[model samples]
Target: MQRFLIALCCLLCSLPAAAWNGAGHRLVAVIAWQQLSAPTRAFVSAALADHPDHSRWVERAGGHGAAAIFAEAATWADSIRNDPRYYDAGRGEPTPPIGGRFDSRRQRHWHYVDLDATGRPVKGELDRQVERLSRLLGTADAPDEITYALPWLAHLVADLHQPLHVGRSDDDGGTRFTVENPFSKRLPFLSLHAYWDELPGPSSLRGRRLQREAARLLSEHRPPAQGDVDLWREESRHLHASAYPHQAGSLLPIVDEAFQRQARATAERRLSEAGYRLGRLLEARLRHRVSRETP
Candidate 1:
């Protein structure tokens, strides 16, 4: 394995960040957390408690409750993109087990899939990885794998809902298409993908504001049906047509108020749907295990 975050670093230098920023992922997490049954939430909390980066999540949460911890856990997959302890799982030997524990290689490609014009995945492994990880989590005797997979499942379920995560390979999910946004001075110019990533809200979102945002989204968008992973990705792919803004009389596309409003609305609805789907998925996958193991 490459010691540094090689591929992720290269992608970060050239492209925008993950499918959703920290806030978007956390919002989805909180929304899901709100919907989960008590047993499932307990099981989720216990599984995450065994994670290697659990301490890091606690520290980052900064004296928050279990909800905050779960929310932070949702972003762990993205947070490790730059962490030194995790390395890229290159074509090297499989990461060896340490003390009989599963390895923690950073599989950054798990966040998105690049599709060809025919909708075949040209690159990335979002759907397949989620399915593979879900199976691993469902197994009876894989504590280490469950610990590892929980965070990834939390992150990827939300990612597959992002339109550009299922985007075309021609522009690398719109990362090649630059856009200008005069509304925010901090981000005047960025890729269309990055602009969509930030539409759910600021990366620093947390506490009451995060709760309010999640509540608002859940209220506006009713709990979506429990769609399969492939179905979720297809839904996102269908939304790609409207994800990009029409370029006005300028060389670069500028995000106008109307487009931003529409994008934000779409993003919030997607986030709500992802949250409910994740909650239902976790309940189905983990409830049986919890019932068998617990009283």
Candidate 2:
């Protein structure tokens, strides 16, 4: 069992430095889907169908239905990290993808907002981008623009719920610090950010298993109250300090059974809240659009 735990830890450590692994993002989408009204779901389906990568998402889901496609699309923002089609801004000039309202540059800074110990923004556009994208999705008249904004908005909302993303820049949102896990003797230390990112479970989780887990999360955790991005960011920021494992006078914090247990619970709660909050946001945005168009 120890060897297996070590292997799992090593595998999780190797995952990309996204807020949550693919499974977590997808699970959030699935849980959100459960809360969405039928009209909101239909709006989502229509908007996604027009996405440039819609076909690719369908293919990846093995031609699954709308729910699977929606779950797949939740990871699209992170998916572009390795995609050559989109280059990081200021890094290089690649011929932009030839399509409607598409900015081919990967907006890496859109993922998180790093605040200083005093709560001043040092970098990252996550808060600003979420508000902008949410507004754009709600008010945009162009189909293509809606397509372009939907995935980004969905993704950023989930990212905003991750405590580290809204946390301090002191340790680069916990990525700079390494925590030792006693469960793994061979590979005892891993980045604190990576440890939190993997708490939602494996990156390959999908399909029925994903749905079941999401359902279980919903059952176990109550939905968060309706709040704007600012409120959400504040909540995450407050939780950030507590995310670090505490050890008296020790530079390195050790992740023992108790710490892991609490961390896992916190991570799961965040995931659940992310899903419910996203659902409410989408429903409001889409329903407003419907009301405007009904005239």
Candidate 3:
């Protein structure tokens, strides 16, 4: 509960309606995982097997098949952030991704790169990690590397596409600003970042049903022109500038139907775009391994 409030504080100043909630992440994951080549799917499954949450994912899978695992994997980074044990005092500040074979803690900063409010891209661990993991996936294909990279890749890709996650030199991605409840009554107000996060979908999308929703979304939207992080960053910048306008002093913005419609459209499209790009990235990197036997 303490961690929840801290995250709530960091996620936004007011009550948290959403900060890229799990249902949205799972929707993005299911859409991407379904498009994977069978070999890529197998590779991803095998990789996720090493995740600390794997057994829990399997148990939660129940009758829904592996879709549950895909969804659960999408939320693992966020789960670890909320987990107190990972934040135990022994772990140093800035929380590095635990190194070596026994490492269990997550690298908190790996999730999002904060671009300056002026929109200059601030280089972050996310960019480096994505590049490194993509290279390893393409050439190295080490089992341990694959196991670690896949989850981070999935989480980070979705994270990059979130508009606020890529913005603001100051503020925890707009966690500093607050707004009236136009999205939902669950919270009386929302932080600017949390508002964008909630734009993707409801807080809990009922597991397997979200997969079906992902499929529907895919049918309606075309795949990305191609996956490019630069393109993703530019896309985020536009969404932030046009749709999420603010005043000089940080007064709260009013959330009305017009704003919600535009944000919702952008978020859904981004979710689909992120998903297709994830599939493309994985397929490009992992397809070479089809002929090699699993280690």
Candidate 4:
């Protein structure tokens, strides 16, 4: 019994750490938080109030507290860095110098494909993760516990919106190719995978201004309809075949242009959709909770 308890303790302790890593995941959280509506924001705020560490940081940061929240989200990504299954194996470890192509087979099977595809989880593992999150949130009655789950859910959903996160199994969704950043000459800081991760918009924007920019883009572009999702899937497949192959060649300018255009469009649509979806979920949940508490 003592041995079992020790093992269980270790496993339990490792679980949170395992979930944390992947900047991609944290980036989703940052985007989701930025895109939240008023009610959704309130729900997130109430949920976060239960978390002393996160709450304390927010409180200390004051009105611009959301910035701190995104910083925390970024930090959380580091915690889950060791979980290999969460990322594409093709990227060959998260560090750098990634080379190779994405597996076509994996792309078909995973719902998390890329800018073109939406909603398919690679190998159906994402559904199980969502189920786990649901269970966790179900048992969590406190605001803090709820807040913890909120970010996780929000972030994961956003990650799914990122076409690269759903990448192919073999090439790990373009994780192998390395490219130089057009904006920076400091180093050859480019990878097919990294390019996808940072796509569509400049990372320089922050706070409400960033949120406003995303909102404006969404207003201008609009979300793809259900029919559009199919088109995206087809386009993603095409991109996988054509773009992934030439990603490493002397086609830097062409590749950069393609990535920028796709990233911008995807970012606007997904960010807008995340806000709408999160608002719907938060409203339903909050209404029920309020009704239950009412005299």
Candidate 5:
């Protein structure tokens, strides 16, 4: 019995390292739902009650870590390339498939696809994916399956909002450049790709600390208009153009008050936008479905 207990402990300890780092995003989702207009919250609550297991996906996806859930869902969503917007315009190519090995190269390409194209195609794909997910939610036989898939959908929507995640084919959307940590003084740890994903703000501040800061920022900025999508696209374009490895040297010099303030502001605004958009999508789906289901 003692040996068995030790084995279980070892297994549990190993699980966290491989998990996807999605807590920040998940927090955004939860908070976003909570902050919704009462009717919107009611719609989500009804949908979840109708499919109790779907609600649990939020916790499960966060548990297995971010990468695992993302890979699994991306794979599923990639299987059906129904969204026309993801297709390459001139070449007529489908977006590169999702859910295989994490090719930093291909992932970078996906980022560009999101940035350059209209959100319509991506939104269309999400709509279909959510339909499939909602169907799966209606049936309770596969709780674990639903757990992996529902959160996967949630995470991917958030990914679409990350400007870097919408990067183009060049520079693998910033993955090609290796740079040192200006603040840590450690060996260069991340590519521009990673810096966008993880290093936008303070590492020490996490969970509620991060969520509260993000919420505050969102409140201050007000909700974005559709035109803001273009603004986001242009911002990514400029960041991509400004790439110079030595510029990383300047990262730490400004890491004090100025950097922290700027980073927090940017992260907060972007993340809040992501949450708000996600809420709108969820609310729309729930309203449509509930109307259909009613007699």
Candidate 6:
């Protein structure tokens, strides 16, 4: 178990600092938060008021308002990973058993599913969480339940768009594939996954201007035509096979200018697509609820 965890961290490190990382997740949430109708925004904000982190959110958000709270909440699923308070007291696992029937256990895997090089399937938590979230919302469950599930839904939708999340890496999701960075001063030790993870650029991208970036991207692009979850995964798979890194006899991935531009473009496009889809998904869910309640 210890070895498994060590490898997981190493693999995670191989990913870029921003790919489905804090900045990326925040960007997705901000985008969705911006586009949600006033009614949907009100509903989500009210549901989120019951979150265990509401006090902390208030502290962190300061005067940023509910949108900031909602954006930060998008990262809660990832944040719980470090907080032992969320862990089961007796079992000492990160997943604490809520009174609910849902397998609120194993919060980490909710972000992604990985496949092997041989094309054998590995169970990912994202699909399971999506279905669970649907049922939770469909039944018109309490806000507390929706609050618990909503973060996962928002986050997983963004994670679903990260090519590395869906694509199989030869080196444990490319945690092993080292990179020769384009920056002349840098060494060739960074992993390919790490390189792609920063596709949106730096961690600084997660600031007050993230909304502007998301808005600009939205203005520039349209939602992908084939936008189903399954198709999204397949698109990632195609990128994994063809778009990730170009091999040129180097033991590590040596990213050239051309490759960097193409890869960055792909990542940017995916972020736009993710934001659009997440907004649409939330809007559709709200519409569904309204339709159901209208009778």
Model 1: how far is 261 from its true place, Å? 0.7
lDDT of 2 by residue, 1-295 (tens): 6645754565456543577888888888888888887777887888888788898889877655788899889899999898988888678877577354577877889988999988888989999999998898778888788888878877888888888888588877777767776665545667777777777888899777887899999999987897898998998899876788876213357787878898889889988998998888888887877555433
Better of 3 and 6 by lDDT: 3
Question: lDDT of each prediction vs. the true structure?
Answer: 0.82, 0.81, 0.70, 0.45, 0.43, 0.66
Q: Give the candidate order by descending lDDT.
A: 1, 2, 3, 6, 4, 5
Candidate 5 lDDT over 127-193, as tens digits, reads: 3444455455455363344444444445555554555555544444445544444454442344545
- Residue pairs in collision within model 2: none
What lDDT tens digits, residue by residue, belong to model 6 across residues 49-136?
Answer: 7666767766655566777777777777776665655663346644544433334443555666667776543745555566567567
Write one digit per residue (lDDT tens) for candidate 1, span 223-271.
8878798899899999988898885524457788888888888999999
**Which window of ten consecutive residues has the lowest lDDT sum in model 6?**
97-106
Superposition error at 140 for model 3 (Å): 3.5
Candidate 2 segments whose C-alpha is farther than 4 A from its true place: 1-17, 98-101, 184-187, 248-251, 291-295
Between candidates 1 and 6, name the one with more favorable TM-score.
1
Worst 10 residues of 5 by lDDT: 101-110
Candidate 4: RMSD to truth: 13.4
Candidate 3 clash pair list: none
Writing each residue's lDDT as its tens digit, candidate 3 over 1-295 gives: 6534643554444542223788778888888887788877877788788766678777665556665687777777787776554663456644434433524665666666667757675744555566676777777645777777777788778887888777665765666766655457676455777777777677577556777789889999988797477788778767766556443222346666777777778888888988888888888888777547444
Roughly what TM-score does model 1 have, to 2 decimal places? 0.90
Please report the candidate that would top lDDT against the real structure: 1
Instruction: List TM-scores for all candidates, in order.
Output: 0.90, 0.89, 0.84, 0.58, 0.52, 0.80
The most accurate candidate by TM-score is: 1
* Candidate 1 residue spans exceeding 4 A from truth: 1-17, 91-100
